[model samples]
Target: MPDPNSFLYNNMIKGFVDIGSYEDALTFYFQMLNNVYNRCNPNNFTFPFVLKACSKLTAFEEGKVVHGQVLKLGFSSDVYVETSLVDMYGSCREVVYSKLLFDRMCKRDVVAWNAILASYTQCGVMECAKGLFEEMPVRNVSSWTTMIGGYIQIGDSKEALECFYKMQKHGMKPDKLTIMTVLSAVADLGSLEIGKRVHEYMDTNKIEIDGYVGTALIDMYSKCGNIQKARKVFDGIRSKNISCYNAMISCFGIHGLGDEALRVFREVERTRIGVDDVTMIAVLTACSHSGLVDMGCEIFNLMRKDYGIEPKMEHYGCMVDLLGREGRLDEAMGLIESIEPDIVLLGTLAFACRIHGNVELGEELARRMSELDPTNSGLLVLKSNLYAVEGRWKEAAGVRRLMMDKGIRKKPGTSWIEINNVVHEFVAGDASHSHSKKIYSKLLELSERMKLCIPTTQRCQV
Candidate 1:
């Protein structure tokens, strides 16, 4: 063992990398470097496995040192070692270095092409990724998924779906990862029809609804306003994991089905799935929306005491929201003050103040937030709305004036309706849409017709 040569050291490093013990792999790599008994050096085989380990860990500095060793040991032109170096640099987000090595290669294979392509995609350089993707003579499922995920990461869900459709048209069958990624794109767009299409495709293809796919389906259906279908998917899964249960609970929570969420939570407890931070957040959200302050408090206590999960920022946000919605502003404030200062938690209380017509509390929150972050236009809008809601028109106008002076404009409320798989977006108080004139005309007609249908006395009161 004291005089172990390169082969043994390489195998040991490869073992750790293969088992996903990346740090252990690097440790063995360093050990091989300091092999005092035989003065053994890492060969080309050792460098690739070592680089693979570095890639997974995103160990940029360690990878650089390995790269130096590769060059110093005259293994610089070795294809496997070069490819691994390319992948390592890519994973570390050093795209320039990755691209440099990739371009310097004498012959590029599918694996090499895919590695650089993934680097660009992972760094959100979609244009470069697309270019490289199209240039590659052979494209694999990973290539397509990388592009789709990159688009999704950049908030271009429509493009992501288009890429998935193109991927299908090219006779590339989607694996579970690709399906899950596409489902996420559908969820972001709230495209129920497309989500249903994906589900049907899975059924027709007989793809096993594993935990990843099941969780993705549940999330997609719930986001698309079909909680019943989401629950059906959850039920259909043969072996449900904590993720599936969390997604289902979140589905019900978002739809304000608090009781159903709680029932599912109890089922999770009964099944001994054991609650995590995510589970608590989902259940707390359900309670917050359904005005179940007492139940929320009980669950919050249960999370800390029974589950031994400390309250995260999200958990505290949910609790504050629940208590604030129930008009327990002081209680919410007291609880929040016990923790660190969080702008999101403060904003939650500010919203509650507006809802309950507590102008004093709202003003206090507004002042506090302004001091913390003057660039927060959303908080300014909330403060302004609070004033307007309580008939303080002068104060509301003053807030608006402050916004104008600071060159700040709040993002308008946006709503969307999908018809025949085409989504139409409406922005509040904005007439910039293509069909705005027609939409306004129809709205005016509806208003006149409603006025004519109402009795004169009732119309006056309205």
Candidate 2:
């Protein structure tokens, strides 16, 4: 006990960290710091692990105490200690303090740069994140990935992809993390072609396709309108985890493949795999889309009873939408009344009322919608349309006038045509183009042709 070795203390901390038991490491660290025998080697090894544990536990006060000890022990200027401090503060949501420590570092390594960049990203300060990215003297795989990930988190898929391209141009081979970020961009873009190329790269480079990466691929392909390929990818994953199943089921449900999605859900349930809210919402939405009333009812009942999954607002919205689609206006209203009426739920009610020509309910829902989102042009349009359908021409015109006064213009009606791999968009009454006359003539002819193909019931209704 007279000369407690620093190596033994370091090894103990390392073992605790390796086991992902940060609290244990912190406990041992403080014990060593207080021990008289360990006083001589105070600067040796404990601070880094203590900082990590503090970060992991979000022990901000304890972390500050350790920071004092780190400075007193003369390890304050150490690169590793500085980086840990930056990460700890960042994780504790003290980005400003993390940045202060980062700015004080005499020499910043890749880990330090990555830590600060991640802090900015997580804090949702994208401009500052970009500034830090630009200031990095030497960027590594983690730096590039963190930059791209920040963009992704902010829903800037285009900028994220641009960053990915820049990373590739710098001659740095992207690792699995980079691929995961790019896949996210591709998923948002709904591009099966780019997704396939990424899959090819992963396969050719022997990149291990774990659950996270594999699920991402399935999600990308399915969202891009290739559910079959998504299924194939799902099957190819050797270590199929619950997340993989959730991704596939979500994609299938979203794509209107209700039967296929239900099959997958049943299979997952058979395996005793747990279904979280994401899985439940996805499945319920699929059932709603397909008008599977009985199936939806059974699933909703089972979720609350057997699975014990509490129905969230989204689930309630899906149920309302399902009932509304089937012309069960009373049932849909009952469902909405069962829960607090949020914007989505009210919106669904408005849509159903419009479909059933219930002008009263539509007006009520419109009033609530205006309160929830006063300036939403779509809600105003729905309300105006309901008035128009009820032959309340004066009311409809008044609604439009109110919209104008509020400076909320109805969204322009536009259609897209892909001709020779180039997408061309046309707005209503658009006539500035040289081919305007020809475009109008073709659209008129197509409208006539589409009318001929309409079903008897729809033609009668029209």
Best by TM-score: 1
TM-score, model 2 to reference: 0.78
TM-score of 1: 0.86
**Model 2 accuracy (lDDT, Cα):** 0.84
Q: Give the lDDT of residue 148 in candidate 2.
A: 88
- State the lDDT of candidate 1 residue by residue for 1-462, as single tens digits: 657888888899989888899999999999888876788888988998999998999999999999999999999888888889999999999999999999899978888888898899889999989888888999889888988999998889999999999999999999999999999999999989989999999999999998889999999999999988998899999999999999999999989999999999999999997789999999999999887789999999888679989989999999899999999999999988898857888999999998898999888988888888988999989988998887788989998999999899988888878889887778898898888999999999999999999999989745
Task: Pick out the ten consecutive residues of candidate 2 with the lowest summed lDDT.
Answer: 415-424
- Tens digits of per-residue lDDT, candidate 2, 1-462, equal 556666777778878977889888877777677677545355536677778888888889989988988888789888988999999898788999999999899998889999999889877799999988898888899999988888888888768888988988999889988998899988876666767888998888899888888888888898678888989989888888889988988888888889988999998899887888888888888888777888998898888788888998988888888888888888888888887888889998789899889999889888988898989998989988999889898989998999999899877897545354333557888897778999889989998898899997897556
Work out the TM-score per prediction.
Answer: 0.86, 0.78
The CA root-mean-square deviation of candidate 2, after full C-alpha superposition on the true structure, stands at: 5.3
Clash pairs for candidate 2: none
| Candidate with maximal lDDT | 1
lDDT of each: 0.91, 0.84
